[model samples]
Target: MSFFAGIKAKWNAKMDKVLKIGDFDKQLTEIIADGVVTNNELETIKRLIQEYGLTEKDLNIVGVKAFRAAFKAMMSDNIITQQEESDLLAIKDILCVQNELVTKEMAVLLEHQELRNIQNGILPVIETGGILLQRDEQVHFLLDCSLREERVVRRSYQGGSQGVSVRVAKGVSFRVGQHKGRMVSERDVVVVDTGNLAVTNKRIMFLGSQKSFDVIYKQLIGYQVYSNGLDVHTSTGKTRQIIFDNKQFKADVLQLILDRVTIQ
Candidate 1:
């Protein structure tokens, strides 16, 4: 037998001995009443299942109450931490409640926790392009290349009181030059190679290009969706536009930005 099977057989044997005492419901209720299932409580539950030869139906009978109690404990503080979310999901799986109504209910909480992790930069967000760059301890949401499109960018520079003001037909860039004994500024046109976009819980990042920039989530004012791409507006009044080959990608990216930015 496999390791798990062997363990199951051992638990089943233990359970058979325990069933003779006939306190399964009482023991299960006691374990679940605290609204949290600790390691010992989980072991006890496993033993009860093994002893009673509990099938899915019997498991759900006990599981529904335990799931609710565990979920309530996690939500008691009005915020579910990553550990709590993981634990609850594990409990749901172990209780064989995967098909229960409570499973769907807990999914919302799990999704919220996932989004929360992304927003807090506790997760790594990644998008595939010509290259992939990732690090530990970062949240990366990868929007596939099916959603990316290329666009031509043009730029121009004009001298002003503030300095040389450079503007791009697409995004923004800066260039330094000397004119008439003063620092003359000119608009620097950016040439991007193998560009892709990614949104993390903390920021929106452009990757694999010289003009790559990371815009923090807090600085994002809003985004507009176009048939081919998306336009992201920052708090600085600058807008970055990205065109995707897929229209659905445009919509999905827009919705992702809206969902992420609104929560923060």
Candidate 2:
């Protein structure tokens, strides 16, 4: 038993030395998370990664796991107390932001590269030499803005049995009022303030009537620019033609966005 215990202890000591996190590892990750590290530290890490051919994706995944392990060790070793758990959780949230940003950048890069490849390889073949191709192929343009489904609460002029009469703005607004309030003139009812509103975005596709429009939408989606529905403004006037398949309540904007974009 004593001989076996000695062998196990020796193995553990050897493994710990090889797998320990060093100053370079923590410093590099801190800089990656925040830019506080000196420019030289940033360059050093960048150079080492470049020399070793390591990618951002590789670092993020590895860093997440390493930090999680470190956090666990800190927890177990009394390095961090119970009150510090919230602080660690907040750090984890910051790490999540980094993860999301890295993912978004990768997606944007891949999508743009794909678009370039398609324009180089497929577009010319279709435009110049493909069969049944015409000089004026009725160039159809599609504009895909980020259109998300939203709920617009409408207040009725008359109160019901419950005495609930208020409008809930779907988009961020400037007006804040209670459900039970005296009726004010239309002019007095201002748009809700952007600060105190319950506006949220959902991931969805928007379609306009053109190809260039579609490309724009793709770029906006990659960049996270989105809207609740179609906001079409022309030289003469502005019109919103939100397409929906609902047979009833076609006049309502909220219903239209929900019908066209969201699953009922």
Candidate 3:
């Protein structure tokens, strides 16, 4: 190929990529125009992300914009209803937004839902994950946060020294040695795993990378709310701390649980 032809071809490709970005943004804006995304629209979003002209980074940029726009549209009224919340979640998942990336805004949305629920004596009903829900069980958001569990670890320390052995008799010898260190219990706060933390009308469920469990509202004996997380105690004498990036989210979850526990 001629040098000029090669240069022109490369330029055309670059221009096409830029054009694809504009097209992707326009499509996304339209999809989220009504503040909701339909199941059929998912394919369109996915196709745009996978467009051959754009790079992975470019797709993500477009997707993030759409994701944020969806959030704003749905919550424009300062409230995200059950269906709108589902739609928002769908957009997030399709856009591949990690839980940590969404901590702040999602926390705010949950707070909105919780406050609204209080006014009407309603619990935010949501689709449950993995664990089978019992009768009357309704789940809220599946939070992406750190789960902390207490565990016992043994550490050894030197307590004594060894002495030289000497021959005391023809057939016997005397030897001296130092004693071993004593074992002591030490408590530490560590992150066991990270994953979705869902609160329900009856329980607090966590599905994590290395750990998963549930604490029922009835079994929830007490909880201490912190700026970044929560320490919950269950009737079974188990204590777990769930950590979030935002203080407001911690308060929101605590408040929602407090309200739910009263009537459960």
Clashes of 1: 14
Ranking by TM-score: 3, 1, 2
Model 1 TM-score? 0.41
- Model 1 global lDDT (CA atoms, 0 to 1): 0.62
List clash counts for every candidate, in order: 14, 14, 0
Which candidate, 1 or 3, would have the higher lDDT against the true structure? 3
Report the lDDT of model 2 for residue 184. Answer: 36
Per-candidate alpha-carbon RMSD to the true structure: 18.0, 19.9, 13.1
- The digit string of per-residue lDDT tens for model 3 on 21-118 reads 88878888998988878878977887767765556567677767777788888878877787787777878777777667778778767776767676
Q: Residue-wise lDDT of candidate 2 within 180-246, one digit each (tens)?
A: 5454333332222111101112222233232111221112221211233333323333222333322
Winning model by TM-score: 3
> Against the true structure, what is each candidate's TM-score?
0.41, 0.28, 0.49
The whole-model lDDT of each prediction reads 0.62, 0.36, 0.75
Better of 1 and 2 by TM-score: 1
Model 2 accuracy (lDDT, Cα)? 0.36
